[model samples]
Target: MSAAALVVVKCGGNPAVDADAICADVADLVRAGRSVLLVHGGSGAIADLADRLGVPHRTLVAPDGVTSRYTDPATMEVVTLALAGGVKPRLVAGLSRLGVPAVGLTGLDGGMLRARRKSAVRAVVNGRTTLVRDNLSGRLGRVRTALPQTLLCRGFVPVVSPPAIDEHDQPVNVDADRVAAALAAALGASQLVLLTGASGVLADPADEGSLLRTYEVPATGAPGRFAGGGMALKLVAAREALTGGVGSVRIADGRVSEPVRRALNGAGTVVRLSDMIPSLKGA
Candidate 1:
């Protein structure tokens, strides 16, 4: 199958999102001869396991106000276990039940997803800006596409997750949305669909009726003040996908039926590089 026919879907880890529906949709797509790759996050599962294991779960707010899970050594272990041991298996099994040949993989497998470990992350902690040195997170550096491509060629749907390997061969937490973006770009996928709990990107985060049909991200800075919480990160990932050669990117509601198909059929906020600020076109 041509890479241009490939579609990468990232399923949000929100408990309210329907994973089974997404799996069924993926199975339908596969049967229709469209190459699909599924990426997922397990934040909810991570928190649950952390609670069961008596690990204190914490979050870090960057100076810019973007919040992320604080992955200390303990939290990193929980993340790895929750994603690989919990989430990936269920997704692969669900796909198989739907008659789709599926394979589960982590970024640590085949060195497929590589990153540079962050020694410290600057964040606002306890109302004071500080450098958090114990963070075990990383920023993606490279994606080895051969593994996924080979699997896709063999007709297996690659269900992938994080805990990407870093420079020293250590597992480090990485954002799952960015992982989808990297894979979509690396695979030259025609579309990247990010399914969340809400109805696309809303002008008013609280109002679903305020859903924007299209959102234009600023070329040089953060999306906008309205882009808060996970939406901000999703926008960043969408921009990266568009910039990295994805044909289009959509942020849609994962709660709806046939979410992937809906997004592909224009049911979410469509983001494109051409919609960026004119002055900062190449920035």
Candidate 2:
């Protein structure tokens, strides 16, 4: 199927995420008459700059042996600066230069993304499981659907960053994938393209053949395929979007030409969630 009314994209902050390339790709999508919401991460730069400044970068070990980033107060500040001060504006500027009439805003603006505090996180580091304390992470709550709809209706591309505070007035850092998922569901997006560094979700970690061209996952699973770390969380978020009435979710390599445009035409790891699990069980 062609991309829907709203195409929500998550661009990773990895060096390979290629902001310029991403901007051009989105411009192409817009030129093709598609309404787009651009969401991005800045953690890669945040980590680099934090290390250069001698700030402590923290990771934790989950009981299941997965490593994950733990957002403390300092990290939350860094994330805020990175998202607001850097990522959001830069993309907006580029899109504007490309004649997209883009506008940058934190999820807090007009209550675009109201989130709940995530008090606990699990991870694995240095061969030890640990509970991540002092998590300032956020979960999405109310999505100001009207703001995006208004922006789209007025021909402006809305670029969103790390969410703002909760209604209770707490600023929590949220994951980019979760943001993408929530945006997809809120907009009733036909396709959610997650541009990551990897080729796609692999069936086996070691073999290239493990690449899953299409993921028609069961509502429940055996666990190892997407367990132990961020992948587990991503899979969970994907499920949330799919089960909650979004049409589809795809995780694809972002370094190529027109990644977003390509993803819409079945150019990556397409997770066909609009269908049921039993139909593909024997295939």
Candidate 3:
């Protein structure tokens, strides 16, 4: 498969998502001669492990209303253990069972993902803006595509996840959606599909029928005004992929059969850079 045929699929960490179905779909795509790179999130698994280990799992709500995991030292440890030890192995095994050679990798592996740690962040806590200084989360800085490209060339599906290595050469939690976007851009993939629990980017979160076929993220403001919770971050990731030169970005439901194929065929919300306001394109 050529670079234009490469597809980056991100599997959501929500427990409702069917990982088995996704792996099966990936097998079909590979058999049909499409190159695929899988990136997965493990928030549910991390929370579960944190519970069992007696660690407090918390979330930080940005002023714009986007909520993200508050990855302090303890939570960061949980994130690493859950994704690397549990979630990744399960995905690799599922693919192997379906006859797809899958290699599980973390962002720290071979510096596949490098990030700059955000030593502090401003978040809204109980209606008060607080400066969070100890959160061990990082913003993605670079994606090294050689490792994944080599695997894809050898007919192996590379399954990747987060805990990106920061400038200090330490692991820090990073959002998986952003990871998918960065990889898609670096690989020059034709499509970046983010499969989540929701049907798509719904105009109303309570109604699945209200799925927006296309959402134009504003060039200069927080997309959270249009979407709350995880959807907000998905929109942000979509914008990044589009601006970074990925052909297209889609937010689709991961619970159904053939989720990836459906998204590629336009079953979900599509985001394109052309949709942004022309005057604010570079803002």
TM-score of every candidate relative to the true structure: 0.95, 0.86, 0.95
Candidate 2 local lDDT, 86-158, one digit each (tens): 7788899999888888988778788788888866776555666556668787777877788878888787888
Residue lDDT tens for model 1, 123-242: 887789999998899999899999999999999999999989999999999999999999999999999999999998887788888887877776657666557888888888998998
List the lowest-lDDT window of 10 residues for candidate 3: 274-283
lDDT of 3 by residue, 1-283 (tens): 4988899999999999999999999999999999999999988999899999999988888998777899988888899999999999999999999999999999999999999999798899888999999999999998998899999999999999998999999999999999999999989998899999998888778988877787777655677344789988888888888888898899999999889888988888887554343222111
Candidate closer to the true structure by lDDT (higher is better), 1 or 2: 1
List runs of model 3 lying over 4 Å from the truth: 274-283
What are the clash counts of all predictions, listed in order?
Answer: 0, 8, 0
Clashing pairs in 3: none
